[model samples]
Target: MQQQTGIQTNPVAALGRSTISFVNSLGDIFLFFLEGVRLIFSSPKQLTKIIRQMYFIGSKSLFVISLIGIFTGMVLGLQGYYTLVKFGSEGLLGAAVSLTLIRELGPVLTAIMITGRAGSSMAAEIGVMRISDQIDALDVMDINPMAYLVSPRIAASILCFPLLTALFDVIGILGGYLTGVTMLGINSGVYFYRIDTSVVMADVAGGFVKALVFGIIVSTISCYQGFNTHKRTDSVGPESVSNSTTAAVVLSCVLTLVSDYVITSFLL
Candidate 1:
């Protein structure tokens, strides 16, 4: 009878345990982020580290961001023109494209791209360090690994995400101009006019806010995953590093999208 009861409740028990584990993980990640942020201000010499990280996370990512932004804008211009033409509203294409890019796509796409590029690199680098005991060596040298590694990344991401998002918005606007004005015969003046009139400071501000939030999410999650590579249950050693990198990228992208929606709701 006891065995029968235990079997019947096993699935329920497993579900409860999983739920608890997930909640605990959330708590841990939050705490980890707090510690990293606190450590960012712990030392005055951190500016050099932050700058190096900025070059890697921001400058190195510029070309790819520009390429993606232009293509995305061009696609929007083409689709928006076709859709609006049906309603005799093709002239509004400029406003549509600009608003869509500024309010939504620009921030979200930039964050996702950076997650794939810099965030993955961050995870892999840290994960390798963990597997190789480089992080432990830092500890032995009396270095605070969190400050030396995680804090600089968080600082760089915070500074870079907004700048990158702004660049993306501008390039995307140009791409739309190429498609709409040069290709589809939209009046160059009307395109500029609509964009100027339609995009307000609020729209731009909201996009930046989203970028900032996404930066925090991506940097923290990637660093956390890498910092704890050895704790991954399904793999060990180098295999764990790979797994952590994959998980960091996937999770950062997901969280960026989720947070996008949440921020949009609040901003709206």
Candidate 2:
């Protein structure tokens, strides 16, 4: 009876332990994000690193962002045209496409794309460094790895996300113009006029705000996952790195979408 009792697991204890661990993880991630963001302004030397990351996370992503934006806008134009045509309001396609792009799809899609491309890279790179002891080496040499590694990425993301979202919005609008005006016989002047009349500064601001939030979420989650790769319970070394990278991308995207809804509700 004593041995059986000793070997038995307590469900309540297990649940409590799991809850505690989850809370501790949340606290750790929050602190990690604070430190990373705080260090972004620690020195002017970080400018170089920030610029490099911007190139990787922003400039390199332009083609894909533009491609996706155009197709999304084209599809929106098509759907909006058909839907509004039923009521003789097909001319409003431009307003529909522009508003949709600027208010929602633009920022969300841009963030998701960057998360897939750069967020995964960030996690994998840092995870590899952690497993290989490179991060520890930096620590032993008195280097602040979070500053050296994470802060610049976060800064770059903050700077790049809004810009990318803006680009996507513009390209998407042009795509709508191509479909609605060129292909579907929408009056060019009417198309642009509707867009100019329908969109306001508040709509634009809200999209940028969402982009900013997504940037912070993606960069922080990616870095946190990678930074703690060695602590993963399920795997070690390369497998752990891979797992972290997957988690980073998945979590970043999920959070970006969830935050989008929250931000939209507040903005509205």
Candidate 3:
């Protein structure tokens, strides 16, 4: 009966277990995040480590972010022009593209891109260190692995994401301009004018807020996943690293989207 019960679990009991597991996971991640933050402000600052992380994360990510932004803007311009032209409101394309990108796509897509580009790498790096006992070596040296490993990453993400988002917005706007003005013959003056009038500081502020929050979430979740990987059971060489990396990327993206919706609901 006990063996059969394992196979045919009670729905209520299963749900309760799942709920508890999820809450516990959240608490673990949250506690880890706080420790990272606290370590950032504690004594013996790791300025060099932090700077290196920033360069690796922010500078390395620029090309991809720009590329994605350009193509995305072009697509938006093409589609938005078609939809607005049908209603004879094609001039509003500037406002539409600007609002869509600045208010939503700019931050969300940039974070997702970073999650793919950097977050996975971070998780894999830490997972590898953990597997190799290098984290233990740091502990033996009396180094706070969380500070050395996690805090710098969190700080880097917080620094990089907003800048990447800003760059994305700029490049995306230019791409939209190329499609709308050069190809479709939108009045350049009217396009810029509409964007200027329609996109206020509030829109920019909201995008930055989203970017900052997304950055923190991605960094912390990725690091936490890497830190918590079970070396003894899960370490199948690179499989463990790759698995943790994949989990980090997936969780970062899900959290970004959910948070985006929640932020938008409250802000807009």
Candidate 4:
């Protein structure tokens, strides 16, 4: 005798599951951004917290960023000089360095640095709080977690990133100068002149805008990942920190690049 087995399935089940997942993800992202905006306008009461975070995220990370920026600029100048020399256009080296650093590289690199330095820490700290019920403790005490935790970090990012980018821009330009004039023997006056002429307020403005947007993205994503650490307290271990960091870095990079294209297209 052959036994017949019944196959049980719902045709729309997969579709419904996908739809709900998508909607939930969208809602999470929306709320993340909304919380950021809400914190932006809340008050000045969190100034002390914001300043401390700025010191951690911006001031403490300066040495690393400056070192990276210098090397990046030097390499860019050397490569650009050689490439431009092929066409007897080595004089354009300054313009190349300034344009690349200010328009694209500076903001993006600073953001990446901050992500590795601060974003991971932010996520891990908040994730631990969530797992340990510290966040719930705040709720039980009538303290607003959004105001106390997320707001200060968001504010700090907004204030810190642009400043860091500007610092990177200056350090990068100096490195390019050293490479162009000292290593390549390009005339100092010509180098500065070309850079001055090539770079404008619009370029600086666009880059700062990119930095600000990236800051917001990084803060929101990291905080959201941390805040959502509910079900799996044990699972919110070291691996969760790594996952959150990876997500923040990847998302920040994608958003920065995409926003760059959009901003440049609109501005130009």
Give me the overall lDDT of model 4. Answer: 0.83
Say which prediction, candidate 1 or candidate 2, comes out ahead on TM-score: 1
Q: Which number leads on TM-score? A: 1
**Residues 2-87, model 2: lDDT tens digits:** 86675467677778888999899879988999999899989999999999999999999999999999999899998899999999
TM-score of 2: 0.94
Clashes of each: 0, 0, 0, 0
Q: Which lDDT tens digits does candidate 4 get at residues 38-132?
A: 87567777778888888988899899999999998998889999999999999999999999999889998998888878887888788778877
- Candidate 2 segments whose C-alpha is farther than 4 A from its true place: 1-19
**Clashes by residue pair, model 2:** none
Candidate order (TM-score) = 1, 3, 2, 4
User: What local lDDT does model 1 show for residue 262?
Assistant: 94
Minimal lDDT window, size 10, model 4: 1-10
What is candidate 1's CA lDDT for residue 130?
A: 94
lDDT of 3 by residue, 1-268 (tens): 8977885687877898989989988998899999998888665577778889998899999999999999999999999999999999999989989999999999999999999988998998898898888999999999999989999999889988999999999899889999999999999999999999999999999999999999999999899888877542555777877788888999999999999999999898
Candidate 2 has an lDDT of 0.94
The superposed Cα distance between candidate 1 and the true structure at residue 82, in angstroms, equals 0.5
Cα-based TM-score, every candidate? 0.97, 0.94, 0.95, 0.88
Q: Model 1's lDDT to the true fold?
A: 0.96
lDDT of each: 0.96, 0.94, 0.91, 0.83
Candidate 1 deviant stretches above 4 angstroms: 1-9
